[model samples]
Structures are given as C-alpha cells and as structure tokens.
Target: MPTSIRRRLAPLLLATATIVLAASACSSEPADDGGEQSSPSPSAEPTDEPTTDATDATDAAESGGVCATGDLSFTVTEKSQAGGYYLITASAEPGVTCTLEGRTVEAGFGSGVSGDVKPSEQAEGEPITMTGSIKAYAGVNPHSGPQEGGVQFEEIIVSAHEGDMDPVSLKLPGTAEVDQPIGTNWHTDAAKAVPFSS
Candidate 1:
C-alpha cells in the first residue's frame, strides 16, 4: 500500500475507535428511573401543643375548697360583751384565704356585710381577720338575733375564692376540712377572745 493512503486510513480508524468507546461508556452508565437519591429518612418532627403555665397549675391545685378533716390554727382576738360576739384573726397558707360566717349583728360586718357573701370574695391572702358575733336563734331567718345559745360559725368555707366549698359547719378547732377537690382549712384552739388592737 502507498504511504499516503496508509496515513489517511489511520486517521479514519482512530475516529471510529473514539466513537465506539463513547457509545460503550454511555451504555454502561446506570439508568435513573426519575427516582430520588437514597438518603437517610428524615426524623419525624414533634407536634406543637399549648402547655399549661406553672402559675396556672399551682393555682388549680390550690384553688379548690378547703380540705376536710385537719388541724387548723386559729386565734380569737376579741369577744363581744354579750359573750356571744367574737372577733378572730386567723392565719392560713401563704396563698390561702379565710373568712367567718353565721355571726349575728345589725349588719355590715365582715364579708357578709353586703347581704350574702359570694365565694369568690371571701378572704384573700394569709392571715384573714374577721370581726363579728354569733347569735343563737329559733327561726331560720338570718336577720333575727340569736335566741339562747347563739348560732355557731356553722360553716366556714375557704378556697382560692370564697363560696367555693360545700359550706360545712365550723365545729372542731384545728381540724381541717376538704370541702372541695383541692385546698384545706385550719381551725384555731384559743378560747378566750382577746381584743384585736389592729
């Protein structure tokens, strides 16, 4: 063969080999079926929900009526001249409130001065002090004065608010009562009613 023809044939052969190699490489490549690349599955995110406030939780636990059956410390500061009237100063839990009912007087005394005392407005905070007297009477009417023995603080209900308890009779001193789902009450032991200077 002629030297010039050999040169031309060599160039053609090189071009054909390059094309073959490229086709083979493309065929060997893996096919993607439009699928996403394999990756670690993302962890699920937590759901969002409103959480209870610490203050609200504490209030709920301590807001119920007084506990039934417990010892409560009470102090009688003043007693009426008629032996029936009494003035008392009592201390409750730091956040607890206290009040006294069933006392007799002309009117406008203690929390009940506004006729009927509601539960929400009883007593608030520690050391709730009330000045009033009890009267034992025959008729069920509260307006009437006590008849002979005088009506006891028949029911003393304390809660985060007033009028929250079942209204149990204040009988035993130092004994606490759970009249509602939460909270407790304390009764005093002092007998002689002393003068409350404050």
Candidate 2:
C-alpha cells in the first residue's frame, strides 16, 4: 500500500477504536447504577410490608373478636333531652381491640331477664369495633311511657350481649325512672344513641 493510503487509513482506524471504547464505558455506567439502585429495593419492600399489615389489621378489626367485659370501662351519664334518658359510653382499655357483637347491649334494671331493657330500634344495627380512642355509645330510656308512673332504679346491669359471662353493673348518674325501659343500639356517634321508640 502507498504511504498516503496508510496515513488516511490510520486516522480512520484510531477514530473507530476511540468511539468503540467510549461506547463501552457509557454502557458500563448504567450497569453500575442498576446495581446501586437494586441495593435499596429490599428496604422498599419492607416499607410496603407495613401497608399490607395495615390491611390485615383492618380485617382483624372487622371480624376479629368480641370485647370482654373486662376489656372496657363504662360511664353512664344523664341525658337531659329525649324525655330524659341515660347515655352509656363504653371505652376500650389501653391496647385493647374488640368488637361489640350486637347493636344493643343486654341491659336490665335488675338481675332477672324480666327486667331486661327492650331495644327501641326494631332493626338491629351493625357491630361496632372499639380500639384506641374509639368508643361505643348507647342510650337507655328508663321509662318510655308517660313520666308520671315509673319505678326507680339505682343502677343498671349491662353486657355486650345476652348471657354474657362478664357483665358490668354501671351506676346511674341520677335516679332513673324505670317502667318499660328501652335502649338504643350501640353506635359510634353519641348523637345516634337517642333511645326513641319511633
């Protein structure tokens, strides 16, 4: 080959080699970045685990367990409205999670079922779950009849359901007039706890 031909081919060959080397280096960088990016993927997966666990916790709250009498603290207050009634608030104990099985509590003025408080609402309500700051509310109207002729009761025996093994005896905030005592279903909202028979 002539010297001029060699000279022209030499520059072309050198340029081609440099382009190949640059291309190889650029390709290698992305592979290293991919390895670095993969390092945090495991931690990201753990972050998603908490979200999944939250869903499981919600499922447990829905169908998990009933609240034992010992798992709650009860407070009875006199509600001035709705022809005078008793507002019962049940609060969950610390770190306790449980559900109220029925819409209304098994409540009575005395020991026998004859004194059992009738439910004002004909249709039972959805079960309410109590946890953390969540609370369940029920309203008891000691006398649904005209206020003139009603017996007096000092305290009410209450339970989460009928025949509950661990029932609670909550004192009335005031002397309640007792006749045909009626109660509302357990609800999250205190306003919905009015024990009106209508």
How well does each candidate superpose onto the true structure, as a TM-score? 0.24, 0.66
Q: Once model 2 is optimally superposed onto the true structure by TM-score, how far is the C-alpha of residue 60 displaced, in angstroms? A: 4.4
- Each prediction's Cα lDDT score? 0.32, 0.83
How do the residues 1-198 of candidate 1 rate in per-residue lDDT, one tens digit apiece? 999999999989999999999988776663332232343334443436434575677766554434221212333222334322233334443443324322211111224433332221123223223223311110011222323332234333322224334322333233221111111122232332221211
- lDDT (10s digit) by residue, model 2, range 1-198: 999999999999999999999999999999999888878766465553457778898878664588778878899999888888899999888887788865676789986555678989888888777778988899988887654776677999888777679888988887777888889988888999999866
Q: Give one clash count per candidate, in the order shown.
A: 29, 0
Q: Root-mean-square deviation of each candidate, in angstroms?
A: 13.5, 7.7
Q: Give the TM-score of candidate 2.
A: 0.66
How does candidate 2 score on lDDT? 0.83
